[model samples]
Target: MFINFIWLNVFLMLCAWLWVSYNKRAGLVDVIWAFGIALNVILASLIFETAPLMVRVFLAVASGIWFLRLAWHLLRRYCHETEEDTRYANMRRAMGKYQHLGFLAFFLFQAGLIVLFSYPMLALLNIPMEQWGSSTIIYLVVAAIIMLVAFWGESLADEQLYRFKQNPENKAKTMDQGLWRYSRHPNYFFEWLHWFAYPIIGLAAGVYSLWIYPILMFLFLYYVTGIPFSEQQALQHRGDNYKDYQRRTSIFIPWQPKE
Candidate 1:
């Protein structure tokens, strides 16, 4: 059922992308629907078996809240956006006649990401949560704090970038203010960090999956649908300034800029 659910999304998104790729952008509606679907999958997973009811409930609430928040933020920002995400635009351009294949690859990759990071939610139903211990409590507390910090960082970074781009004078300029001053992609960093928190909570609840969280982060930051390809698009669009920014700024970590 889980695998089928995952593939259902992948197939639907792939089909949609084929028709919409040339005419429109991926919208917030789709993002919200995706989040809701993922949450539903996780919730359904909990009902099948495994884990103390309290533990499963707690993890489900935590994950559901986080996902909903992310979906809200993304939806609001993309509300008026008509442009294809630069990532998709560049992808379409580079692939040209092979854009259909590119769409399938990216669509499936996204579904895979949704499934991988969601392992904690799904895997819990396969393992008993009564195995939770004192050490797991510590991990959960620390993870909760990290969740706040990561989500906050992502929020501030996005707000700063948004405001910067709003100014006519800064329209053509590279953003180097606020969180952007510290990291080239603060939002992406937090997005990666977000996945770690879930696994920690899952671990705390005595729910474990084989490398699900780490693999999700690794692929998101390095390969498939992540930064390497993204940076290439940025370089082409932002010109040498983005290249200079890359040299001076941390690619994935948040820190004060060097003097």
Candidate 2:
């Protein structure tokens, strides 16, 4: 089942690579990746009948809502923006003649990451119901609450940024209102926060490896793909305004702005 799931993700990402190559819009990979994960979760729940029905249902519904919302949000942005995202544009420029091949590798890497993050869900489904402890209910409740908060925060942050971008006057200005005032990347903070819920949920099924989700997400968001690229782009476009925004706002976690 797990091997089949990996193959499914690879197939979907391969299609995404083809679409991106044609459109020269690598940003759409994010949308496809999110949808692919949701699809995989739904399929897994259907196939893994031996798992606890309640657990399966919770995983499917929660993951479906979270990932689908993100995918739709990204899709809307992809439709609105005429140019490739600066990050991917930069990568493509750096790759030059090998850009297509490079993106194929990048897309495949995303597929591998999807599989890695699915570890918690798959582990839970393989565990017998009788193995789940009494604390399972408590964990589920806590996980649900965390997921809700993370989802709401991410949605609100994205909406705020989208509306800010829609205004012609705001084109070169840094967004520093609402959630953006507290964190430079509130959306990313919420994204990372949501991963914590999975580890907590995994605790119910004795899946220690689930902790890797949040850790890996933090590493990628903070250092690798998320903040570094975004900050560089912002500095390039908005110059000192973005630098000042960075000074006044926390990079990931929400906090009181600097005076």
Candidate 3:
């Protein structure tokens, strides 16, 4: 399969870090810290080795597209912005003398996560879950539709926020219109939703043994990088307005804002 071993993941992580470092953005890497995830985005395909040809193609293309999207989104988020992301500033200070150690630990753990998050890739990579039949086409079409929904949701959310940020008048306030009106973190919510398509299609194949795909995403959204990290940043930046937004808006699901 495309992802044979953890070594590939490690290599990918290092490459990401190297790219970040080359750009003099190692600090950004420390803060936004996206390299670890690229590995997950790619390694998820390791499971395709045993999957049906149709299933494998779907997984590979889905994952490839997903990674490209995420990579572009994050790069746009972090690149060219000189702000130290606040998240990394505290982390770097906390690391102190062992900051180098912190980067290593963070990168390695993210490598594992890349492995962890790519469960659909593992589930559908090489497993003969579906044959080239009507079922396969249905799976592909469904997956593609879900993927488009997910892609659009994320892209629109990011675009809206980017434009909001660009407007000089919107500074120091919370974004409570557009997609932001419904979900406190529209981009992140959709980012998690994107993972659902994989399993919807992966299960259509035959790999049900690994359920880590959905569970980890759920956990990540609530506990890890999703709400936890974003909320922390929001509290620091937006303060009371953000708190009100959180109280009125759905944390995970998309819905109308409180009237």
Task: Give me the candidate number with maximum lDDT.
Answer: 2
> What lDDT does candidate 3 reach at residue 12?
62
Candidate with maximal TM-score: 2
List the candidate numbers ranked by TM-score, top first: 2, 3, 1
Off by over 4 Å in 1: 7-22, 26-38, 45-49, 93-109, 134-136, 205-212
Off by over 4 Å in 3: 1-5, 16-50, 129-134
**Which 10 consecutive positions of candidate 3 have the poorest summed lDDT?**
28-37
lDDT (tens digit, per residue) of candidate 3 on 162-228? 8888788998888888899898888878887777776666556554554566677778778986688
lDDT of 2 by residue, 128-209 (tens): 8778888888998999999999999999999999999999999999999999999999999999999988889778877788
The runs of at least 3 residues in candidate 2 whose Cα sits more than 4 Å from the true structure, single-residue gaps closed, are: none
Error of 2 at 33 (Å): 1.0
- For lDDT, candidate 1 versus 2, the one ahead is 2
- Which residue pairs overlap in candidate 1's backbone? 51-128, 51-129
TM-score of 2: 0.96
My TM-score estimates for the predictions, one after another, are 0.78, 0.96, 0.84
RMSD of each: 3.5, 1.3, 3.4
Clashes of each: 2, 0, 15
